[model samples]
Target: MESAPAQPGTAEWYLAEASKLRLTPLDDKDADPTQDPKFQERQRKIVDLATKSVALTHKNPEKKQQFEVSARYLLDARLQLAMTGDDEQVELLYENARAFVKRDPASHAAAHGAHTLVNLAYHNATQEKAPDKAATWRSEFAQLANHYLQTFPREEPRSVPLAYTAGRLCEQHGQIDDARACYTQIVQFTPDSLHGSEAERILRRLDLVGNPPPISGPTLEGET
Candidate 1:
């Protein structure tokens, strides 16, 4: 039988539990759990737990850096949860992301936290019903995506996803040239990799044959 959900706990306990969840695979029986509601629920729960853990670390300076790392995990998991289109849940998740950034501005944590905001903004634009709000979110996404791409360390392995995210954000906002540049970087940096393959598909979709139109001297605000 499956186990019952855990009760919320102190920072140390929550952090430990979240760490275990992070290390564990979603399910051994299912080859892919991406579409599994149970998987998502579990992920959401784990992220919530992580947020609680972050809360406990607020007063401990030694744990502040650790909170940054946990925030990344929390934000990613929260985004996954938000994909279910649970509006109330998404609102809380957004707040959680905001709290994460406010708590720690460490570069690594901030990068991941920025990615979380991008996901929320994109979700608002594409999935929500409010046009004005959607436009606002898209605008935010564009700025966040650009900043993430520009600031993240190019040599780090983590740059792959950040670049891909920037490309997708540009594509969604109709900044074709900027999107292409970001995608092209992924391809050039790691041609045979997953992100590179996805980037190539985006380029093909944009119908650009060569060099992505040169990014065009900044000012990559996208169409609403």
Candidate 2:
């Protein structure tokens, strides 16, 4: 005999229903999925199901695995919505990411959360229209990048990229000291890596300011 479907309001039911929605995967780099009404509808349904699943399993000690899965779904949904320019969803994404970190500072989830914050910071810096808002996000990015470097070991895969981004952002914003610190960390930890090499070059450039030229040669050909 065939098995019966899971009942509504249960974790299994939520997951099953969300899976059946068959929403398009978020992999099309050239198209905006949010611009499609059908896609948006399906996404909203999945988000709702995932949210309910998370709430249902959150306080149940026996449902720890389900809670984690549901949380992942919810976080992913929020991220998608935020990328679609939904301001409310952006706020929720930030909240959920921070909550993950607060729950377990050393967990993989915390690292993922920090990375999510970094993405949002980049979006704000590049996409936000208002100068004041962009400035605020840049400040937050600097703080979060510094926190990630301090909180996670240098061996973390994200450490180098985050350091490089932070350093570049700092340099763009005239935070020379902060930029130097970030570049210094990269050179110290991964001197042979591409980022490290770039950081070293930038450091040399920074150091050259107000100092005599190493060699009084003219600019190289095609090196305006």
Candidate 3:
């Protein structure tokens, strides 16, 4: 009983602390029809299970496989939390994901990390609601993203995410042409994955926003 409290230290408190921390995980999502009560319940169960599974990951070599599963689980949970608007849980889940990635090679994490930072930064940049810490998170997220780009080099599948991250960073920083450039690159390089759809959507968004003059040339990876 002692382990639990009436929301004893609900994950909310850590949101600020976590935000201030050096590493914040990325954001992603799940299917909708999430408005249904039953579906919502199911989602919560899945999140709980995912949280537990991640909690069980061991550092030992024999348990290395579990670590990967756990990292992925946390990633899924982060997506779910974002959908439900539980930003605190999203942040906490991100911490777990980052810690997990550090333990091993986070294949998709580099991109995912960039994704979260962009969301955080974009929200901050919004006209109506830039919270006090918004700039901090925006900067922090950009650094993490640059770290990913620098560390990972080029993989055929990863270009779209990299493009998205770069585009979001440019948008947040007010580099409209740079943003257009990144999105255009996504259109060219990431034409296969789910990111391809995202790339198209972003291109549409850029058009709507009237960025004008898409940026051109090879991606940071040079597509070699």
**Which prediction has the highest lDDT against the true structure?**
2
- Show model 3 residue runs off by greater than 4 Å: 1-34, 105-145, 154-156, 159-161, 164-224
lDDT of 3 at 160: 48
lDDT of 1 at 222: 56
lDDT of 1 by residue, 105-187 (tens): 55456667666766666666666577677656555655655555555555336556756775676677666666777787777
Clash count of each predicted structure: 0, 0, 2
Better of 2 and 3 by TM-score: 2
Worst 10 residues of 1 by lDDT: 209-218
C-alpha TM-score for every candidate:
0.55, 0.71, 0.45
Which order, best to worst by lDDT?
2, 1, 3
Candidate 2 local accuracy as lDDT? Answer: 0.75
222 in model 3: Cα distance from truth in Å?
A: 45
Instruction: Write one digit per residue (lDDT tens) for candidate 2, span 1-224.
Output: 98998998789899888777644465554666657655667777877998888778767879777767776766766666676778888888888878877876765556666777776677677667887877777767666676676677743478688778878987897778878888888888778989889999999999987795766556777343
Question: Which parts of model 2 are misplaced by more than 4 Å?
Answer: 1-5, 21-30, 34-41, 59-62, 169-178, 185-193, 210-224
For residue 161, what is the lDDT in candidate 1? 77
Between prediction 1 and prediction 3, which has the larger TM-score?
Answer: 1
Model 3 lDDT vs. the true structure?
0.51
